[model samples]
Target: MKKVALVSLISIFIAITVLSGCSSNNTSENTSKVENTATNDASTNQTKTNDTAVTNETTTEQGVPEKYDPPIEMTTVGVNYPTVKFSEGESRTDNVWTRAYLDKFGIKLNYKWVVDDTQLEQKTNLMLSTGEIPDFMNVTDIQFKQLYDAGLIEDLTDVYEKYASESVKRMMTAGGPIAMDSAKFNGRLMGIPYTMSNKEVADVIFIRQDWMDKLGLPAPKSMQDVLAISEAFTTKDPDGNGKADTFGLAADKGMTMLNGFINGYHAYRDLWIKDSTGNLVYSDIQPEMRAALQALQGMYKSKQLDQEFSVKEFAKVSESLAASKVGILYYPPYGGSYPLQSVRDNNPSSDWTAYPLPSIDSTPAAPQVGASTNGYWVVKKGYEHPEAILKIMDFWIKTFYENKSREVMEKYVTTPDGNTPWLLSAIFSYEGFFNVDVQQDIKAVIEGSKKFDDINPIAQDTYTKVMNFVERKDEKFWGFDEVYGLHGARAITKEVYLANNLFTENQFYSTATQTMGVKMATLQKMRDVAFTKIITGAPIEEFDQFVESWNKSGGEQITKEVNDWYKSK
Candidate 1:
């Protein structure tokens, strides 16, 4: 699930982990990030120019890898996702993608064993503990370090330089050096990072417009308005049920959507932000967070916030949304596609739309973005062709990302069975905001500013889905239109938050600090408990006590270690 994006629009998580806010246009287009440590000066689109210098048996004169005469065979692990259906005679080993790897690059991709995508990490982890691994595979950040520390991985700095395509290099650097640099240790590239869009995780407010129209309320321009709408939806019978049976907002035990409301107060949970004194500090413990918790406390007491939120999961919240028992929601860009669109399905008159976050006061709320790069593609030590993975990756980017073609989409990317086979590829990497780029394409086509004929196959597919909803009133494609539609979540995210620079990326992009590994899980659980207590009507002073407890319980050491890492950078 970690590499979910390589398969779908998310269809958006990132938190690299499905993760999930924002405010004003025009006033806020530069990303409101804290001090970013990346200074990677790698030339954009860095390319090798030896068009006529045919190298040895493994590479072409143009600096890209050419097919080997005997074929370079590598043993690796693979994921067999249930959603990926092969042609009648094709299996994971014989699919269009795997066949192309051998036919085009002369690489024999042998799967040592295959498992469900969910079990890939467990299988990989088992292999690592046993002191053996496939020729190449993806691993978590922590696992990457373990492999490196044990001298079980290859250094890909030179391998990337020699074998990577121009497009691959560009994708790696597109989001800046952090994504690529996260793979580096002692200035050596250990793996190829899977980069994603922070904006994809940034949530927005999704409200039922029919409910708002019924209440004669103005759309939210501030957090105050949001609260009022919440109150009205909960109290004024917005659903016209004549029963006080609705919740003002959707929430869950994980606090997924509610965090958007919390982020509006300028408090970012699970992020290390820079303070006025130029030191990195954890965000959840800040004073601003206390204020936000107090607000939730009031909402909970008033029954505006879901009373059962403490017991419900995101799936439960989605059920509430579909049942029309909830009005306003804060979720990732994919909310419409998942929970919100279901509301319309159950009730044809219901319409859910996306809006940017509103400020709490004079200052705009900057949507908190977590680190987008998580998994890394690494090769085992002493593999005969460590660079083979790069050739496969280069093909993926060109065929699926750069100028995607309908022929490839039908034959290789998406199958006639309505399945995705690209996820079956041996390695995965992507432009962080590639989908947002597609959003622009769809937007341009709708505006008639760009010819629909010029858009890539991916965007063309999106256009068809959107038009299906717009023209035929198709409930099946409702979520599709909700995201790529004229005022879809991505549209607001790109046209407003991005264009106005109302979002901020987390400052701590490096791997976990030493203290993080030992204490982070416990500290996270403790913080969630404290926040939950406060949001459920505990005394506001409970936050101060919680802060004191956190400081004494290794939080102080973690902060120091975090700052040490930041300062070293």
Candidate 2:
């Protein structure tokens, strides 16, 4: 297990971050003193929270508002994943996170209703159509645009600057301009952008290292090596079952697994990159795409890929992975937590390794990531305390980043059973680069240049997971070690791709351009159908037809609009 760290590797390519700029040295008790100095109204010492409760004037001292004297109520909707579990006496409304909102801030969080995450969008749309929005809620970009256009959401421009902790402010700004701008419509900050780990969208090839060792094959260095290994994994029975039922690569109807392979041809899917003329151009329609599609079609014809890939969903493909019917997969860093975790669960000895996307020639294959902000936290326009949401958010950030400790983590963040109680909170937005940053901190710690306690809370949590898996061989923590340990997904992604400037991202981030809102869905659907046809059996010439049909059907106009936006920028 290569335990050496990436200190020199990172220092040569990435700038070092000063941790003290974000981490607060204040003890928990000191933080409490700063936060709990609220004026109380003796006339009403109420326990139950409601908007009508008597309270003194609200004030903020160092980005934290004083607790509501007589308690105040706020309403929101929630989604509970199937894995979410509560203690024997608790439910969605009375879990660890909700209790803290009340106990620490005297803020009662009432969920108008809870539903499975799958139904959240439909339920939210119905709620919006009926104009029954809660005081604060989590919303997608589409919902945010709808609410903003309808004048239904509060403006948080000043509220955010006042109540958001310094650490939180820095975290939000680190995502670059597009992330912060995503939550703004017409220059009003109507939503708190729900940022994601940027690396989460980039691709890394997850290969079955056990199969490679058994086949006596070296790690792939180029596109040719990948195809040759795929052939061997498909025909040589790497699983040793001897029945020829295994597959060389994992794929699905959505064609997501082919993303890395497509990149090998120096072509990107669903992104806008510059052409030789410095004009913004959609990548899928580029000439390079034909070669990638033809190669994929050849692989499909030869049975190197899953025969039913075009009909199976990614979930079904993951099931194939868990059943040991496939080997190679292309995924983001969190791949270890999903299909790769299934591999560990089904066979404890199974090993998968992350590798950088290989190239067809000397030029490296650049992985693509979309915009960072995926959702938003918004407040109703007329809410009495739009800043109340920010107050709660201040507590959440302080708990995890400022006054971090194992006791706090166990009591408030994650439970012993590995359940994250923090998800029960009404709102949460992570630092955009959290996961990648944690990998850097962990590497520094392991290299003896940093102390274990000095690393960020996220790194500490991942270290705990790695130690649990290493010392106890706990199956649940297996995925953590695969992604965050010394030689894991982050090592390849952070130390290789990102550090070396070998990754790309979409340039058109000004959400849904003029023609895009009117015609993009149909154009994207046309491309999907056409590409699928080409890869499944249609002649490679069909790609040319797709381009021609696409250009005639709104693609040309969208291209013009996009270039206009680019030129304006």
Candidate 3:
């Protein structure tokens, strides 16, 4: 019996061992399957993260997205001239179109502060000094440098490369490589340049066509002609008002008013900077500047200037223009738009034409240039996603400026659609000269009907107008080419004639120089004192004393600084 039990136990042990082996094999197979599954899951998750970066877009409530988050929010500061507040029935934060667009794309503008022109710089400095740095600040070059040195801003080189859409990268500056170079600091992009091309015809000297006819004077062709016309207007009673109210030119010689003639004569106040070689130089210290001042002094003495030259504010000059007390003035369209509109509102019979400033003797010297670039938005140093601003910039360049060099448009217009009409005609102002005709180009390229190369030259020109510059004052005045082109010649000479009569092309200036700034302040003060004294019949030779004092006080330093800057450039 014992032997039989032993055999049975031995057989059971073998059976148990075989069963255990089979179980272990099955467990191994299951473990392998689980590992593979996890691997696939992780791969999928990584892909989703990348896809979110590329394809993530959505709308939010409040008409537009008030907060965009993946999730993050950044505070920023901004300023607007004349205040960008909406009129009655308008929202302070968002416009209808902006709200709709923002809702469609999930973005928001969180303004830390909004200042008017008067308070912009003061507020900016106060914020900076207090270490209450916002996410970003958009300011002028000098302001930018200060912020940069104070550790308030960031080096945007790598951020721009990684996040900025290719098109936004291209728009860092205008005037090609040179302007972009200027905006860079310590070999890194400290700021993005405000890209605007040089518009050839900005300020044009406007004369009353009706007044010219009444006076029976052929359109004044030269400085002498203008003087003759003004003399006649003052003494001959061209208005037949029987009062000595009409003046040769109703200029407000306030430092800022009637400054365009100073520009036409290349005699812009203290801000007249020029770039030579690679450095900035001041223009006020030039010998030609003395000539310009002397000429203005002469005009003041002859009683040909506005009678209230010293006390008149800039806004008053426009009032004079609209009220018909002024016959000729140098102004940009934007400066004159309200007054001109008001004139039309009051008298439809008042015929007003906007033409470019005539060239001085058919040379480049005849033209006066203003700010080549305007406002530019900047990204903050360490916003959770500096890329978000770049993405927004990309969107603006693509949607508003028609830039096509980014990945965002992979789905919208599948192929190059040259025939696609523009949907944003309201922003583009299709009726005006600055308009870009991109609708057809979009349509043709997408439909496989046209290649980008086949798009018309006119369309190309329109594209150039949009992306290469900031918004200009007048639709009629194209860029520098059109100003110097055949269509602009007649008007060029006309401006030259008027300007020469008033003053000569004293110097060339770049808008961004340091030395000219100081000189300009001193010269302006001198002019203010001299003009007031002379017009009130102060000794004319006080001009000589003023000039002497000017050179002695900061004037010599400014001249030396400017010349040194020029030489360095």
Candidate 4:
């Protein structure tokens, strides 16, 4: 009976696999035929001409010879962002668009682990330390370097250059590929890179619009205007409770608010420099930091910031803002969503909107553009069919380009009139092939998409949200566009558009992508202590002392290390 039960399980598994159309056979050569049949069955919407273009361009028609079943699985690991949900019971095995395309190519996905959004770094470190390393891992810069130095990761320079599909190769040339160079150690690619857009935009300050109107105040247009507005909202008690319980600004003490205040000053909290030739060098150690510290001390002394902020976790920042107690917040438009969305849901009459970050010197400083770090699928070294993984990747390019699968097209394709098919398409028609059109559309909208009178409220809301962000050009606060667009609704907005621009072509070493685990661990503590004290106004004079302590406690070393890594690249 036990044997029969085992046999029954195997049979059931096979049936499910067949019905789902994903083959996990023992040879690489079977990949092409399987993928072809699946693609044909999956969709009939694709024109033959378009599909032929995919087949011919991808070399899917004649790349690997027939008859061999690919025998390998690519292991991937990353934080579980909302867009890439992997719940064991809820997630579909073959239902994922990317996985279905790979089924045709005879490659299998084996996830190493799924971590909560907040605890990703911690879980990743535990995995690394235990040496229970999976075949591939999506790690930060600190982790990448540590693993490479420990010789746990294989170099992919030759493989990437020689075997990377045309689509992947093309992406490498579109600027910021220099970041891939950061993963290079002793002249070899240590890991595959996850990519993000390089377009730049600043964070915006969002306020409760209803409060502004209630107080008969217009939107803030300058730094002093913002301060006055904040003061009024806090001290004037716009909420009508008549209690002095309001915080003027909702800042998580340690985090920098410069991005939301990008209207005029090119500020630096960490290691900015000025060239002898009069260029503003990156300024972690500048006199400007002193002035910035002084301003922050004043805010703390005035009790304008959240007093309980030091104990807040990163995710909870939204909670405080959403409660309608935070009169002022600094973030991108979408960043305002948690609070705004809650307000909209619980009280649709709630009026809230975003505005540009404040300017210090009346010039837009360089926005912080987060280095491109994204989900990447990579193969294990010595896998019997490494070619299978390459073929799988090639299959994705074809699948997305040809828009072949009905399942995907139904989900993702939104017509100009906004008609969506039942399935999801990985390639959005509005987004286009290179992702540049989407970028342009965002910019165009921020310049004014609201002018169209017949726009849907959802679209209008999106536009309002996005436009609130576009007015600022600082890139640091605008890193999450692709994820937001892919995960959020189809409606375009100024913030989304500006975020699209922030993801353009530049080559900075992504500190987030490097594997500097030890450095990160040390820095977190120092960051917590220093930021809290600075924001709470422990003392203005102690800032210099804090900086000194921060340096002694590894902040300086990390900076030097990062610079060294940058120079080496």
Candidate 5:
């Protein structure tokens, strides 16, 4: 019966894959054909192209060749996160994943150095400044721009076009052209962009359903409703602890309001939005922001917001949530797993549900979301085999997603402890990968064509946790249920996507402008201070003065530079 079930599941997946215009049978053969076509095309175009840098070098057509005639040595630098664990004898440079790369593609990875997450940016900056760049390294947008400007990184346009696997190309551009566009400078692709779905940034309001139920209030639909709820949550003692300690909202100094509370008033602080004339304007200085600040002032004065919020850090704020001291927060979809998970662990009775932000009036709240592309992969200017990076990425995508062989899945995909092996490959995947798959499986399950057990392992794990919560099998699985279950955070994101309510950041400048690079930090500090002061009861009039001061203190120049960059784009 188990074998039959496995075969049935594979058949279903194959059908789905075929419908998506991908072959589920013999991925290796398909990969080889793609590789051969790319290589032939590169050879044919080599003579006609004007790029003198690329020579007519004979290259293997196989995406992951059995072995190179002579093994290729590549050096890179990566963050060795503290949480990453190695097996008994495996090290960063010779781990199971790295060894697989060597065995499959004849690529030997040598780490110039592995730094902790804290030191990655500083050390990479130092390396770039001193011209000690490795063969390939992951770099921030600013560093990528700097390297392109300095002519220290290879123009990967031709190499990537010739060598990247079709699956990779599709995945990189799946979200939109923005991912690839961000990596381009002057119409030439300089780096491999780390792509993520724009939907990942969609903001939602997470409220304690139990608290609402206790107070006999409906889910909020307008700013007025939210305010009334806040007032009630603050005064009614919904936690039932018989103490007047609970508040309405959670906030931290790092991000004063997580999803930009000002967005509820159609004001996006620290973001760029278009005015009625379609001219780009900074959100912080707008009149809408003044109204938002005034509203926050009212909340603070009414004791609906935390009085000590200005001084609270993220950990402290999360602790307050875990202790049931706060009942509302604006956060991204992933909040179900992190701080909210801790809340479930601490107070199992708490029930959180996500809702779209309430509008100030009849106009729906369109919150401004931002990009999630953290970094990119770039090869040194003179690396002999820039395509090696793409080849490694091809291997990762194939092994991680397409490979259905049980042996490969059990050995390479999962660790000995039955956890997913963190690939940390130098490639980006669509942020919506798992959620999109889960959503599809959900539809299939609803239609009686699939079961939760038939989904991918990660989704299956999530399903198990959700079932555990729904069936009351475990209290700890409540967070998983809230995040990955049928009516969870992912569902809310899907709704936002379907409703066309998601708004992306207008600014696509990958790096800071000249004036912005120098003045942005100081300006942000000033903005934070002004916002905190205004929220904590400094006269609301102070916001106008701060706006005036901002323009004078390089804000005008920065705005001009940003607009100039936008026009160039």
Candidate 6:
């Protein structure tokens, strides 16, 4: 009995030990499975995160993404025009304009150097000679050609097509193919042309309405009317000062009689116009130019023009206008804000008005205006990112015109003096950037669909000025009254544009021809001397000799080259 009981206990103890070993094996297997599951879950999560990151990067690289991931640093040289003013603690590199580029596009515009407008060409040439070209820079037509000849600038054809925004493309073609054509060399786009609106070049006759009122003369509608008005302004003592101290017309040494006077006689100087033979003829040599010169000579003889005008520079002429020594002038629409502004500020009672150039006979004068391609923006060769420049331009147009963001307006457009600053960017704007806007605002104001506050910020400032002047809220707003108020200069420009009376210059040569490049300065000097001499009592027959001499000295070659270029286009 005792032996049987001991065997039972031993058997029980062995069974219990076997059960515990089995339980231990099960726990180990469960622990291994859990560890494997956690590892797989972590791996899956990491893979998903990486895929999302790659997708975001791809999206940014593909379309017109507003920002970059890693960010890009672009270097450029900018022109610091004397007219450009910065607030305290702001600079070309640290201003709102530069910061906007960085914040929006991840582009850090580091200026390699900045120089005033006067020194831009000189400094740029020096940079080119030393092979230290910045990433991008604005260059004149001649400088653009020079860079092209040296193969130092990139051909932007492909990049522009691929990356340019739709708005930019539309604006580039706004003035027809001329703006784009100016930037193309041999079929490749080497630079982006900065164009002025066609309306900007349309010349207008600016005269003192007060003087006309004083003399009881009608607004000029013809060359004869203009002559009569000029005589009356000069001899009638329209200023009521009772002295022969004022001249009928204001002219600078560079452009005699201004563009309006020349256009009034149906004559154009330094422009290309179609002749009766349907070929382009240089206007300086045209017969109508001689007739205009004869008219100017007669005016000089009658003391209707400034006697010492030949020696007066633009500044001197502007001073004369401010001092109330001149009553009539010819200028563009914006002239109201410039030299004419001085006139208004000096004599608050002076009322200046703008009119289309008077007719020579029954036909009204259609003044010839050319697209002012001031310069171009170009990228240096071998730059890693040529599209960056286009991107910058895209932002500019959108900010100013398309987006019309209030933040941008407050930060960039508005000045401390409650005025608006003109384009403060390094890039050039499209032609007619604000013509349509101004017209729309003017219409809206007239129709009562929009208040001054509802218009664009820049236009709003203009509206404010116009209102202040019209309501006589401020005496200083007289210039604005003349320019933007009801029946102002802009009205005249808009009317001319709508009537299709504006004549654009036919020549589209972006750079000077080979012969012209060398001899143009000389030829222009000769023409100026001859024109001055003829106007200042020299023989009128000297013009024929001057034309002959001009044609002989490289003018014929230039004409041939120009025609060849036109034909190629």
RMSD of candidates 1 onward, in order: 8.0, 11.3, 24.9, 12.3, 12.0, 25.9
- Number of the top-ranking candidate, with lDDT as the measure: 1
Cand. 4 TM to true fold: 0.62
Candidate 3: Cα lDDT at 448: 70
User: Candidate 4, residues 1-569: lDDT per residue as tens digits?
Assistant: 11111111122111111111122121111001010001112222233332333445554424453213653455655333333333255342233544544434444556666555556667777877876676654565666766666766666776676677766655444434554665566677766654433322234566777889999998776677787887787788877888887777766534544334422344444332434653333344345555665665666567776667666643455566556677776643234333345544454445566655555565533344433433233334454544544554454544443343333332322222223211221211101112223333343444565242233222222333343334443222122231122222112223443444432122335444233445656555664576567667666667677667766766566656555655565
Q: Tell me how candidate 2 scores on lDDT.
A: 0.69
Give a tens-digit lDDT track for model 6, residues 1-569: 11111121121111111101111111111001000000001011111111122122221224556676567888887655443467799777887777766776778888888765556667777777887788887776778888899999999999888888776787677656677888998899998876545544366788988888878889887899998988887888888878988888887787643667887888887876667866667889989889988988988888888999898876788788889888888865545655677777788778788898888888778776654455678898999888888877766666545433344444554433433232356565543525435645755785689765555544554555556667656776666556556666666666765356466565755677788889989999999999999988899999999999999998888878877777786
TM-score of each: 0.87, 0.77, 0.59, 0.62, 0.82, 0.81
Stretches of candidate 4 exceeding 4 Å from the true structure: 1-103, 106-143, 146-155, 162-166, 169-175, 197-202, 214-218, 240-245, 253-259, 262-265, 268-285, 313-320, 374-388, 394-406, 409-524, 553-560
Tens-place lDDT digits, model 1, residues 389-487: 888877777665663345554455554345556567776665666556666787888889987767765666666667778988777778767777776
TM-score of predicted structure 6: 0.81
Q: Is candidate 1 or candidate 2 better by TM-score?
A: 1
lDDT digits (tens) for residues 499-556 of candidate 5? 5645646564458888888998899899889988998889988999999999999999
Model 3 TM: 0.59
| Residue 542 miss distance in model 1 (angstroms) | 0.4
Best by TM-score: 1
lDDT of 3 by residue, 1-569 (tens): 11111121121111111101111111111001000000001011111122123223321222223345333444565444231224367442454323433553455556677655567667777776786776654555566666667766777777766655556656553223544554566667766555442222234555655667777877654554555766776666656678876666656645444454455455555444544554434454444445555655666666667757677665666566666666666653322333444444454444344344432233433444333333233455666655555544454444433422222222221112221112111111001111112333423443577664554323333323322222443332222112222222223333443335332221322233465565666566666677567545666566567667777876666656656544544
Return the TM-score for candidate 5, rounded to 2 decimals: 0.82
Enumerate residue pairs that collide in model 6. none
Question: lDDT of each model, Cα atoms only?
Answer: 0.71, 0.69, 0.43, 0.46, 0.65, 0.66
State how far residue 183 of model 1 sits from its true place (Å). 1.1
